[model samples]
Target: MQEEFISVWVRDPRIQKEDFWHAYMDYEICLHTNSLAFNKKSSCVRRRYSEFVWLRQKLHDNALLLAHIPELPPKNPFFSLNNARQITARMEGLRFFLEEIVRCPVLLSDSCLHLFLQSQLSVKKIEACAEGRSRYTVAEAIQSSGCRVQRFCSEEHSQEEGETDSE
Candidate 1:
């Protein structure tokens, strides 16, 4: 049998709530694995950033035999939090972190990261988000494909214009 691989990425993070205690942000994760145990499953899940950190901290205690796991993007005040730019960058960083873990044979097999990738959001977390009672932040990473498609069409039009102008 061909070797199976795992892939994971984060996307579409938005500010779910900005209130005290109940404040939260949410994002989507896409995971694919072809392992026989996992049966080549692919799934997407919604999550809050805090849940991600909780998973990261849990991994730290068990990563002694593995290479350095990538860091989770910080929720620091260095840049404005809950903004499109910050949220996108954080999601991008998380995407990188997961990609790194997947690339490593040992780290990729780690149960903690796999659980984080494939597990559903806990009931408590879902209820907490529902109770936050705040509006969703409109900003999220505009997917790269949509922008690339638009740019490609515009470039082709400009090229056609250039050809006519030269003639």
Candidate 2:
């Protein structure tokens, strides 16, 4: 039997400007998997810190009785993109939060988690999509929005095995 696994990487912090006075950092969330639970083989979506907070709250409220939800990184009111240390800390925190989330099977089955990881939809749209009110399925929304879908390569498995053998 093939081993089923999923890996999520949260990186590439880029600041998006809504207007002259408003700007915020968003990270590239890339997921690679052979797990049957996900709709796609791989996906990449850009999300801001606030979106992560919203996901955490949604998961907590919806799955509170089913599983233990992990806490997200503390919100920094004075967040600055220019600060290297702060960016690194937040990136690590966000990565850890996602890693922990994917570990829970109960959480893995949630539509909110699937939409958040797989599509570029806003929080409201994700909620709509999850509720079956949207015209597009998650995969269709992902394609329509032109979100990045990465192709997994067999070479990566060989490289991982080579590194493990050398270690």
Candidate 3:
């Protein structure tokens, strides 16, 4: 059996303006993995807090009988991007959420999770993509659906380099 390895980072928070009065903090979710469970080796998607809520609810609904769902960062109506502490707290919270979910094989297998991490699809479209109604697979969706697919050195190679530097 091949060892499965996956890592996720929630970073690069930026406020997105939908209009003058409507704006929200958006995060860039970056993923790297060697697991075939994921369609891509590396990908990034920008998502807002609402999207994280949707994902948590969906995963909870799906796994209610099977596993414990992790809590998301508390929703703060007064979230200010200008506040460094608030930004750091939210980013760390979001990152912790992904790290916990990826550690669970049951949660890791959800198509919604795949789409959330790798594709730039809306909640509705992510459901559609998972259901085979969409034309693109998660890999193809990342390539064509505005998500960013990044290329990084393999984890093994990076680890070896770190060891050499320490020697």
lDDT of 1 by residue, 113-165 (tens): 55456545363432233345223211111111112234433434444334431
Q: List the candidates ranked by lDDT, beginning with the highest.
A: 2, 3, 1
The best candidate by lDDT is 2
Counted clashes in each candidate structure = 0, 0, 0
Q: Estimate every model's Cα lDDT from 0 to 1.
A: 0.57, 0.82, 0.80
TM-score of each: 0.60, 0.86, 0.83
Off by over 4 Å in 2: 142-145, 150-167
User: Candidate 3 lDDT, tens digit per residue, 66-109?
Assistant: 87789999998788878889999998899888888988889988
Residue 64, model 1: lDDT of: 76
Model 2, 29-117: lDDT tens per residue? 88778888886767778999999999999998889789888888899888788998999999889988898899899998888898899
Q: Comparing candidate 1 with candidate 3, which one achieves the higher TM-score?
A: 3
Candidate 1 has a TM-score of 0.60
